[model samples]
Target: MTTTTPDMAPVRLYGAEHAADPERSYELLRAQGPVALAEAAPGFVVHLVTDYRAALDLLHDTETWSKDTRPWQSRVPESSSISQPTQWRPNVIFADGENHAHLRRVITDCFGLLDPHEVRTLTFRHADTLLSAFADAGTVDLVAQYATQLPLMVFNSLFGMPDEYGPRLVEMLAAMVGSDPARAGEGAQAFGAYLAGLYETKAAQRGDDLTSWFIDHPNGLDREEATQQILLTLGAGNEPTANLIANTCVRMLSDDRYFGTLTTGSLPVQHAIDDALWNDSPVANYSFHTARRDVTFHGTRIPAGAPVMISYAAANTCPHQGVPADGFRSGNKAHLAFAAGPHACPARDLALLIATAAIERLATYLPDITLAVPVEELTYKEGTIHRTLTALPARFTPLAPDADGATPWSRSSADRGSAGSPRTAPQTGAMASAP
Candidate 1:
C-alpha cells in the first residue's frame, strides 16, 4: 500500500499546466524516484515508470507484467476519460503470450508485404493532394491542414476504402475520440459501422490493399477478428503519426539548424524527427501494464493488479542517457518513442516513410515557409498520453497555379475551403495507444 504526504500527492497528467510544460511534470515524478504515482484521469492514479532501465526491464518481463487491463478497468468509471484506452479489445494490444504472437503475426506479415517504393509513392500522392489545397494560401496550420489528414488518407487507401471515403473516415475518427461524450459515442458507432462495411466489401471481392490482405491471409481470421485487427492498426497509427509529422516540422522550423535552410541543412528532417522522439515524443505515456503479483520495481513495491505505464518522454531524456552537447539524436535510434519488447510498434517503418515524405514534399512546394507566431506561443492540447500541438500556424509566399491551367486550385477559390481545410476538427480527451 502507498501513502502520500502533501508534497508526494499524485501529479495530474492532463489539463493546461501539463500540456504547456510536460517536462515539469516529469521533474515532479523523478523527485519521487524512478516509479512514481500520477493521476491519469480525475481520480484514476497509476504508477508511472520514469526511468529508462526500469521501463525496459518492465516491458521485457512479460512474466511479471500483463497487457490485459480487465482488472484495472473494473475499477475505473465507464465515463472516465481513461476508459477508452483501458477498454479491453480482441486485438494484439491487449493480448498476452501466444495470443499476442498469433494476432501480431497477421499485422507484421501484412505490413511486410507492402513494397517500400509503393508506400513512398502512395505517401507522395496524398501529400500532393493535401498540399494542393493550401499551396495558394500564404498561411496555413500544418497540424490541421496537412499532418492530421495525410496519414488518415493514406491508411484509408491501404485499408481498401475508396478515395472518396477518406474525408468521412477522418471525421468519424475525430468525433470518436473527441472530448464531447455524446459526439464521441456517435462517432464510435459510425466508425464501427464503417469498419463492418469495409470488411464486407473486402470479403466479396479482394483488392490489393491491407484489408483484402488481412481477409485473405493464411491465419484465416473471422470477420470480427479481422475487423478488430484493422481497427487496432488504424486507431494506433493515425494520431501518433500525425503528431510525429507536426512535431518534426515544428522542431525544424524553430531550430536555427534547419529553420532558414530547411531545404539545405546539416540537420535533415530525420534528425528533427529523432529529436522529437527523444525530447518530445508524440506518445508521451502508454504501454499500460499491470503487475501479475507483488513486485518491487526499482525499489517501489507495486501491488498485484496495479496499473503501471511507461513514460517514453521521461525515460528518453533520463540524465543517465547523456544527450550530446549539440542536442542531435538522428543517427541514434535507441529512444523509446516506439516503446520496446514484443509489443513495440509494428508499423514504425511505414510511419517513418509517411512522415519523411510528408515533410519533404512540403519543403519542395513551400521552401520559404516560416512560422506565423513565435515557437513559445504555440499551444499544446490537454491530454494524458500524447504531446500534440493544437495548431501550427505558418506563412509562406503564395504559389499560384501554373500557366497551362493544369493546377485548378488557382482557378477556383471555393474549392480551397473544402480541400485545404482540416479533414477532421481537433478533438480532446482519451486517444488510443499506438502499438
Candidate 2:
C-alpha cells in the first residue's frame, strides 16, 4: 500500500487541474492507498478515503466515528474556505446520536408533509419563468440562467418566501460554497441574517410552507434550531441539485447512446440522471467525520479525532467494480451520491424530483439544444465539496411565445405582467462561478 512520511507534501485538492479532471486526481490519491492524505486548503492535510469498500465501511460504522468537527476545527485556520462547510453547527450534519435523530426526524417529517405533485408543479413553474427569460435566445448558458436559479426559486416558494428572494439567496449560497475566503465569510454572514429574517417573519405570521411547519412542529424547535434546519436544507439542496441538472443535461446531449435513447423515447430520463450520479456525482468529496477515538481504518492508523472525508466521486467510479454487459448504469441507485447509512441525505427524493422536473421541462421546450462548446472544453469550478460547472453554454432553436399565448412560457410571462412585476431576464454572466 502507498504510504506517506511526515515530510511528504499532501496532494492539493483545490485548483483548476483538480476541478477539471477529478478522476485523475482520485487515481493519484488511490495510489497512496484507500485512505490517503490530501491538502484541502493551504496547510490542512485531510485524510481522504478513495476505495469504495473502505468508504462504505466508514459510512456504515458510525459508532467509531463522530460527526462533530469541534476538535478538528481547532487545527484548521478559522479563515480558511474549507472551514466554512465543516464548522460546527448544531444541525443534523454535525450532531451525533439522539440529537441527530431528533433533528433528522423533524426534517424528514417536514419533508414528508410536502406533496410530490406540488413540488413538481413548483419546479415546473420556476423552470418556465427562468426559460421565458432566454427561451427566445438561440444561445444560452444553462448553468448560469436555468440550472443554478431554478432550485433556489422552487425552494423560496416552498419556504413561504416571495419569488423575489430567489436571486439574493442564490448569491449568498454561491459565495458561501465558493473557494474565495472573503466571499465565503461574507456569504455565511448574509445567509445567517437572511434565515433570521425568515424566522422573524414566520413567527409573526405562520404560512403554509416548510418554514412555518418547522416553527410549529411538535418537536418544538426554538428559533435557532428551526433556522439551522432550513439552512441545511437549502444550502445542501440548491447547489448539488443544480449541478445534477446541468451534468445530466450534458450527459444526455453529448453521448450518442443517451441522445438516441432520449430522441426515440426508448430510455427514460431517470436513466441519464442515474448515470450522472454514478459517474459525475455532484458532491465530489464530503461527509467529513472525526474519529471518536484512536482507530485503525482499512489497514491505516488514524489518530483520535483526526478528520476523514469520503470521496463519493472516487468511490462511485472505483475501478474494481463490475460493469453491466450493456455498458450502462441506468436504474442503479447503489451509488453513494447522497452518501449512506444514518447520515444519508434526507432530501434525496426531493432533490431527484426537482432535478427530473427541471430537466424534463427544459427538454420539452428546447428539444434540439446542443452544447455550444465541445464537451471536452467544459471546466468545473474549484472547490473541494462540489463538482460544479463554470458554465454550460448551450445553443437551441429560438422558441417564441405562441401567437395565441398557449405555451407555458407565454402564460408565465402574462401572469407576471398582470402581477405588476414582470420578471426580467437575469443578467448573463451575473451568476456566481461556484455554489
Candidate 3:
C-alpha cells in the first residue's frame, strides 16, 4: 500500500501507514534507485537519498550542496508546508559556511562545559522524579509519564528556566511536533516569545546555565541570536532524546534477546542504546540539503535549488552498508544516527549520556517491566522526519518512592549492595555497565 499525490508518484512519507512501518517504504524507495524522487507534500518533490555512500558524498560536498533554502523561496508556494519560508530559521541547522561554524562552535563549547558525570547525575535525578509519578501505577504510558517529561525537566535545569515556564515550554514544543499542522506556527511563535523572555531575564541576572553562557560568550550573540540558539538546542535536543529513551525501553520490554540478559544482569544499558541507534534511530530521516547548482551524481540530475533529504534511517539499515553486519553490536558506533559531515549533531554525546542514564535507572528500578499491550499494537507518530512512538504503555511491579526521594534499587544501592554483603565483581557485558 502506497500513497500518491495528484501527480500519481508515490508520496514518499506523509501518511499514517508510512509512519507505522517506514522501513518497508524505504525498501521500495531503494528498489527504485539510490536516489529516488518523491513528493514529500503536494507539489513539493524532494530527492530522498538512500544509498550510504551517496549520502556521505552529498553531505561532504558542501560546495555543491548547500543548507540554505533561500533559493527555494521562489520555487515553492509561501503557504506550502514544504516552502522554504515555512521552515526558515537563522540557526546552525539552516546555516552554511562560516555562519554554520560560528553558531555551532558556541553550542559545542557550551555542551563541552557539561561534565559527563554531572549530566548522568542530573539525568538520574530527573528520571527518578518522573518515575515517582507513575511508579505506583502498575500500568502506565511510559512515553507520557517518564520518557517525554525527563528530557524536558533536564533541559529546563540546563537552560535555568523558571519552574513555572518549563511545563509551558514543553507544552508548546509538544504542540509544535503534534499532529495538527495548524498549530505549529503558533507554537513556534509562542516558543520564540518565551525564549526571548528568558533571554531578557538571563541578560539582567546571569545564572550557571547554557542560556547564561550563550549570553556572555565571546561570540557576542545578541538577544535575538541567543534566543534562536536556545531554540535550536531545545528543538534539536528534547524530542530525539525522548524518542531514544522510549525506543530503548520498548526494546528492553519486548525483545527477549535483550530482556533475558538484562534481567540476568548481563546486558549493559549502553548496548541497548547503541542497538536502538543502529536499528531504530529516533530521528529516522533528516539533513535536508539543497542543490547549489544543477548537479548530476550517480546518474540522477538534481536541478539547481532542488530540496534533497538524506534518509539516515534507510542508510543505516541498508543491507549493503556493511558496518553493522550482526545487528546492534556494542562498540559499533558507526551508524549515521548522529548523521555525518559538517552539520552533524553537536550534542550527541550529551544525548547519549542522558539516554544511557535514563534507561539504566529505569531498568534498575523496574526490573520486571513488560509491555502492557501486544508488540503489534504499538504505533508510531506520523511524520517524515521522526520515528516517534505514539505512546509506550508498560506494566511493571509497583515501587514505592523512598523517603529520601530515591528508589530502593537506585544507582547508589546497586553500587553499595547491602553494607556487609561481600562485593562480587560486577558482571562484564558487551558494553561497559553503567556505574
Candidate 4:
C-alpha cells in the first residue's frame, strides 16, 4: 500500500496546478490510501475520501458523519474563509435528520411539479438564445458565450425572475463562489437580499414557476426558508450545469470518437454527457461531511469535527478493483456524478435534461464546430469544488439567422426574433496555461 511519511508535506488544493489538473493530485492522494489527508485551504486540513466504496459508505452514514460545520466554529476563526457556514440559512444541504428531510421534501416537491418536457423546452430556448449571440463569429469562446449563460437563464425563468434580474444574479453567484476574500461575503449578502425580494414578489403574485410552487407548497416554508431553498437550488444548479455543457461540448469537438459518431448519427448526446460525468464531473470534489466523532477506517484516522470531502473525480476514475480510468460503462448509471445516498442531488433529472438539451442544440446548430485551440490548451477554473473551464474557444461555420429568426431547434414563437440574432463575440485569451 502507498504511504506518506511525516516528512512529506500534504498536497495543497489551493494552487493553480491543482485547479488545472486535479486528477493528477487525486492520483497522488489515492496512492497514499483511500482516505488521504490534505490541506484544502490555509489551516484547513481535510480527509480526502478517494475510494468509491469508502465514499459511498461515508455518504450514507449520516449518523457517523454530519454536514454541519459548526464543530469547526471554535477551531476556525469566523474571519477565515473555511469557517463560512456551509448553509447560509436552514436549507437541505447543511441540515440533518428531520430538518433535512423536511427541507428536502419541500424543494423536491417543487422540483417534481416541474414538467420535464417544459424544462427541456425552456433549456432549448435558452441554449438557442445564448448561441445566437455568438453564432456569427466563426471563433467563439463557448464557455462565456454559451455554457455560462444557458443555465443561469433557465434558472432565472424557472424562478420567475425578471429578465433584468438574470445578469445581476449571475454576477452575485460568481462573486460568492469566487476566491476573492473581500467580495465573497458581499456577494452572499447581495444574493440573499435578491432572494428576499424575489420571495416577496412571488408571495404577492404567485406565478406558474418553481418559486411560486415553494410558496404554495403544503410545507408552508417561511420567507427565510423559501429564500434559502431558492439559493440552494440556484447555487447547486448553475455552475454544475454550465460545466457539464462546456465539458461535453469540448469532448464533442476534440474527440474524434464522439465527433465521428455525431456525423454518422450513431452516438446519442446523452452518451457523451454520461461519459463526461464519469470522466470529469463538474463538481469534482465536494459533499463535505464532518466526522461526528473520532473514527478510524480504511487504514486512516479521522478525528471528530474533522472535515472529510468526497473526491468524486478520483472515485469515478479510480483504477482500483479493476475499474477503468474512464470508468465502467455497463449501461448502468452507477457513476457518482450526481452523488448518492439520501443527500444526492435532487435536481438530477432536471440537470441532465438541461445539459442534454444544451448539447443537443449545439450539435444541431453547429454541426461543423471544432475547437479553436488545442485540447491541451484548455484550462479549468480555479476552485476546489467545481471543475469548470475558464473558456472553450471553438471555430464553426457561422449560420445565417433562420427565416423566422429562430434557431433550428427552437419550437416556440416566443423563442424567436432578436434573441437568436448574431452579435459580436466576447474577447478571449483569458484561459490559463496548460499544465
Model 2 residue runs over 4 Å out of place are 1-9, 175-190, 260-263, 325-327, 409-435
Error of 2 at 34 (Å): 1.5
Off by over 4 Å in 4: 1-8, 73-88, 177-190, 261-263, 320-330, 406-435
Q: After superposition, how far is residue 163 of candidate 2 from its true place, in Å?
A: 1.4
Q: Lowest lDDT 10-mer window, candidate 3?
A: 422-431
What is candidate 3's lDDT per residue for 260-295, written digit by digit as tens? 433255566777788889789888877887898898
TM-score of 3: 0.88
Overall lDDT per candidate, in order of appearance: 0.82, 0.82, 0.75, 0.77
Q: Write the per-residue lDDT of candidate 2 for residues 217-258, one digit (tens) a residue.
A: 898899889989998889788889999999988886787655
Tens-digit per-residue lDDT, 17-108, candidate 4: 89877878987888788888777666666788889988889889988998886676455444443454343347888889998998999988
Clashing pairs in 2: none
The top-ranked prediction according to TM-score is 1
Off by over 4 Å in 1: 1-7, 403-435
What C-alpha lDDT, on a 0 to 100 scale, does residue 417 get in candidate 3?
A: 47
Clashes of each: 0, 0, 0, 0
Span of 10 residues, lowest total lDDT, candidate 4: 426-435
